[model samples]
Target: MGLAAKMDAPRIDRGLDDIYVKETSICLVDGDRGRLVYRGFDIRDLAQHSNFEETVFILVHGRLPTREEYDMLRKGLAESRAITPDLVRLLRRMPPDAPPMDVLRTAVSYMSNFDPERDDPTRTANMRKAQRLVAKFPTIVAAHHRIREGKRPLAPNPRLGIAEDFLRMVTGKRPDPLSARIMDVALILHADHSMNASAFAAIVAASTLADLYSAIVAAIATLKGPLHGGANEAALRTMLLVGKPENAERYVLDTLANRGKIFGFGHRVYRTYDPRALILREYARQLSEKRGQEDLFRIAEILQEVTVRELKAKQIYPNVDFYSGLVYHLLGLPMDLFTPIFAVSRVSGWTAHVIEYWDDNRLVRPLDYYVGPRDAVYVPLDQRS
Candidate 1:
């Protein structure tokens, strides 16, 4: 018998499906309609008309920012982009082959020690911490990449936006205008999705009145899991394994026949096409053309075509991870760094959710029905079976 049946309890939501924990105006994810809205603006509109800095303001403050507010936020992010010398030394001492996500998680936790407001939990202090996280996430990721390659980390250029500065630091040169714009749009697209696994993990930590850095450390660890933030990296590796466009069909059929997963093709929340995937698909195509990666794009196209043909009846569709890997690869990032880049974009949402949860915070304690045993009498160790 099932645990609930044996315990004579009501059926539990195994994954907490369709459960509402609290009200939030930060984002609306309409699975049925394939719409994603941040605050009050549609994601598509934001992707086209706004940059990551503007989008961060919306997610954090709950509305569009005035000119002065936008300028101040941009300035703060620019000022916060540089990691300290201690952090650089930490990065250098870490194992070169260590996973990027683990490095990110540890580095963030370490940097918490140096935050002037690390012990301060006021909304004002948390907001400053959020800004520092948003600004420094890229720097940490880029610096780790450089250190792993035995190179010195580059300093942030104050004149550049977050996206441009990240590309420049990682690559040791300025990015072309198109590439920089694409990176900015990518960051904007990924800024937030309401209460995703990583975001929820962050909320759970924050619910206990943990410091902002502690809560974010929880999020980074959660996002490191394969089913969460690692999908893009897995998806890209699958593409590379397929090796050519013509092999896409056979690979899809073989994987389906064995009941194996196609990493990027499905999502837990989205029933129809993922709006972010739809947005990135176009950018992927454009970047492919510009970077002479047409073959890679064609392979992705064929995989999507075959997967959709076989799985459309089951409501399985391409989600954001599908094209995001291709975009990151075409933009010159390595496969392993894909998820760290994801963290770089998603820290905005994670912090926003944590701050929102603290507005009317409660300890998130839930009960689990016990089914293992009924009041068994304890025995001394010598008499135990």
Candidate 2:
């Protein structure tokens, strides 16, 4: 082996900037161009033209479906909504202070315990589990939250889209139509990215031929980092610190001066606007009008402006995290719960990717460039003492 080939150290948690595996389909992101696509369809077009259910179908099955197939997929999602009564019992029993993501993790773990085919290694069985998880995730998360909050869980409202249904479950009231549509697009935008950290973790775990649940567990751990799924929660907290629109620019500058990486500005992927940021920006606008929180909207606008100017000065650009937290705020979600809600959307992608890996499983072994000191001869145990 060449000197370069002899190196063998782990790829520690430094930022990875290259693709190391083949994926059949993905949400294509041109980070420099600020574009997003699912399979071959652009994110902007999909957000405008599609719903979460259809998008899930596209992600899983690798194409947009005909009307009948879409209907079938929708029905499957609907039918898969119920968590086991025992699952509900378990959720209610979890301590109130338990993190929602932890609750969600337990819920997915419980699913494998209850379902017979959950451990099956075959693609058919794994796909069925994937469909169930994709279907039930929002239901489980929302229901678990409500139950913990001492409210009765709302059964899935079939009349609403998945986003609306989730909101209905969460708030114990129907979301306003415009608000629901905005959130639908938000969920669509968050659904998947190509080989993101969590997705890669899921693929790596499954490449070991572990059961899907085990793989998903590893993925969730990766996502729990503040730099990843936690970004939205951080973004919202940052806006709250600014207190109002007029102060946004000053606050951003102060943060920059403090050498703080303003959460939501940088991304490993997008070099320009995060496509999701644009979708959520529309949501923020709509909510501003409906709720008459124009000041909050203004704050968000200023923040966006500041993000661009500051990041440009620093040679960075806004990523999806930049504007999404404000939309969640305008939608009246609890600030801290933002990342948990992200897990609710991202579970679909994680499971889908895991199943994909299982279909053509291989241990994800990679060569590394090690530069540590060479192996030294061990001293005799007694002599050293």
Candidate 3:
């Protein structure tokens, strides 16, 4: 007999799918309408008009920053972009073969020791630390990449904007206007999604009243999972493995035949196509054309077509991960750095959620319904023998 039949109770576990844990003003994810909103502003508007820094400001604060506030936030981020020498040395000493996400997780944890307000959970202190993490994560990711490649990490350029500076740090050259804008929009699109795994992890840790760094570390660790942030990396590699546009159909057929996942073709929440994917697909196409690498985009498109044709009946459509890999590649980033870039963008949203959760914080403890071997007596090793 099943547990439900024997115990007279139905199994209610669903991984908390479709469960609304709490209300949030930071973002609105309308999966049905294929829309995303941040602080009451449509993502489409923000992507077209706002930069990453400005979007982040809106997320952390409840409103768009005025020119004065914008300048202050920009200046603060620029000033905080330099990681400590000790942090650089520590990144250098870490196992050169460690996954970039693991390095990032460790770096955030290590940073806690250096925080003067590590024990202080005051709103001001948390906000200050959030600014620091937001500014420094990109630096940490770039430093780790350079260290693994036996190159000295570049210092952040205080004069450049966040997207431009991050591109420079990663590639040692200032990006052109189109590339910089693409990166900026990419960052804005990724800044937040309601109750995602990483944000949930951050919120759970913060609810325990842990330090901000610890909470972000929890977020990063959760993002490292393949099912979450790593999907884009997998999607890119899958496209590369297919090798040509002509091979995409075969690849999809074989994967489907074997019951393997097509990583970028579906999302848990979105009923239609993801709005971010819709935005990024255009950028991916334009960027690949600009870079004279249109063949890669062609293959991605063919695969997208096949995936949709095969699965549209089930509402399995492309998510942001589908085209974002191509965009990052066109931006001259290695696949391994993709999730770290995700972290760099998403730290803004993570910090915002953590800060907001503190207003009426509660521990996120859920009880499991036990139905296995209840009321059994304990057996000692000798008795068992």
Candidate 4:
């Protein structure tokens, strides 16, 4: 092709919105019908019946684990849950006020130096790395939370599952059965969404044949963007500002009148309600009642009612972010830790995608149509403009 023809080539899919880069069987997101299926299991069923460890196993392995397989997976995760002492010292050295997500991104990159299989690219090694990542993410987030709070990090309890251990480490108290179960379900819900920004970012990095940790670093950085993973924190702040159920209508009306986004009410892919949000809405209600924060839940309910009434024609509805923040708050998590908690769950999905993509790896280079001047005359060093 000539330069002129190339330069004038029509652009296609500006944001890759209509593109299909690869085939995936990890998760299916049916936006029009409001369904989410992970490895052919409906999200509602998984949330109701499966634990986080089991859910993660299904995502990575593509089938329900046998009882012996489940035991091994659990044991692997538990054994890998503790961070090295050097990592603890690094966390202590980090700026106390750094955003937890930033800290997490850096910490994940640092961990690559110590991975036993860092030099190996075999499928078995990658699977082991994936398991280690899923296990340590909670520990990393919780340890950073404690260090920033001027408290010493707690050692992992080998007997506890990921959700229970994270809660125990972060709060220095053994989680109640209900709170632990809620945390487990929350993890399962956030474990993956098909072709979301961060997961795509992970696969893109992996396409370069990068190591698992490096690809996860890319994912974490991408997820830190407000348009992607930070919505839950922003949404929760808006709810707190509303402060009472009575204020919700005024808040929503004014925000809508000013054409400001009411965070957590819409999604890029879902034209109907987000199924994850539907599951979490009930949990938010239950936890709020238990924690004596029913007014906050009431505020959310009012916001949802008004927003749906006004915007249902546009197909706008509550998304996963809407109730997730409330659930985290009622579980005693701080606001800044919200997005990090998202990473804690999503690392499972990220690694799964990375490993799967590597099975038939290809470079993900896309072309940008050049629009600059074609034949600019070169000027001598002393030539006038």
Clash statistics: count for each candidate: 0, 2, 0, 0
Winner on lDDT (1 vs 2): 1
TM-score of 3: 0.95
TM-score of each: 0.96, 0.90, 0.95, 0.96
Writing each residue's lDDT as its tens digit, candidate 2 over 129-178 gives 87888778888888888987889877887656788888888888889888
Candidate 1 per-residue lDDT, tens place, 258-343, comes to: 99988798777789999999999999999999988899999999999999999989899998998898899998999889889999
State each model's CA lDDT, in order: 0.92, 0.80, 0.91, 0.93
Query: Candidate 4's residue-wise lDDT over 1-385, tens digit each?
Result: 5776877788677778988888999999998999999999998999998999999999999999999999999999999999999999999999889999999999999999988798699989999999999999999999999998999999999899999999999999999999999999999999999888899899898998888898999999999999899889888999999998999999999999999889899887899999999999999999999998999999999999999888889999999999999899999999888999999999999988988899989999988776677898889979966
Clashing pairs in 1: none
Show the lowest summed lDDT stretch of 10 residues, model 4. Answer: 1-10
Using alpha carbons, what is the TM-score of model 2? 0.90
State the weakest 10-residue window (summed lDDT) of model 2: 5-14
Return the top candidate by lDDT: 4
Cα lDDT of model 2 overall?
A: 0.80
Clashes of 1: 0
Worst 10 residues of 1 by lDDT: 1-10
